[model samples]
Target: MAIDVGIIQDVETLLKNLNGYELLSYAICNEECGAETYEWLAGRVEGILVDEFRYLAKEKRKHAAELRKLFEELYPGMKPLEFNAPPLDTLPVCRELMKTKELENALAIAMLSETIGRDIYRKLQRMSGDEEVAELFKRLAEMKEAAYEKLLKLYEAMEK
Candidate 1:
């Protein structure tokens, strides 16, 4: 459950340097990609894990919607950036772990992804010039942290 401080700091620095529009675009793309990933994972997992994966997928979609709403409100006529395909390297390992029914490995991958996402949102929240946008990022970061914590707990229980 412990994320590397160096990675977090690096990501934070990168996010903080973005302008408001760039930050919003980044958030939209990140949320959409996360939603797609979780949905795909849900279909691939089996048994009791299926329900949990589905729930996470639903949550990710909701996160995307929330970000979209905020983006629209902030920049009324501006179109949000479309989600680019995530890196090919990104979820294949998790898919392999799931295929082998390696629950702990799959959950570890998910937890790490969520931790990085949380740190990005946390940085955005701190550096955002607009109060409302900053608040939204704070909430988004909290959601990511909650998801990571849930996965970590499940991983620990599985290990036991």
Candidate 2:
């Protein structure tokens, strides 16, 4: 069976980034729950988010959609949950020593997550056959990189 090049590459991208995706999703979930927000059914919702992380790895499309829903709730109108930083399960290790401020850790995670997402988007943008989607990803990557730079400045200030 001749494979559709686009489909194959998309799958390849997913496979390549599966581990990172899970970790990144997990990180966002952890950060969301990290704060003791008594917003709705926090436990159940958080549980779902965590579950979605594994699901994304095992079933990309479905899991990605589910995770998007979780992020939609988390960020409301704006799509929060950066995709660049290490996956949630491994983010703690990927991030530096954040012994002091929880906020700092959160900031770092979000910053890195967005930064990484930008890079991925850029790559996908090039690979995408759809001109509009490619444009979207290109724009997204720029925005993410900008956000990451802002976070870097913030971190630098905090360090001093």
CA-lDDT, candidates in order: 0.71, 0.44
lDDT tens digits by residue: candidate 2, 39-155: 211232333333322332333233345445644554467644454422332233232323313545544554555454565556656665546445644764675576567667766
**Candidate 1 wrongly placed segments (more than 4 Å):** 1-17, 83-101
| Best model per TM-score | 1
User: What lDDT is reached at residue 51 by model 1?
Assistant: 74
The 10-residue segment of model 2 with minimum total lDDT is 34-43
Provide the lDDT at 97 for model 1: 38
Clashes of each: 0, 9
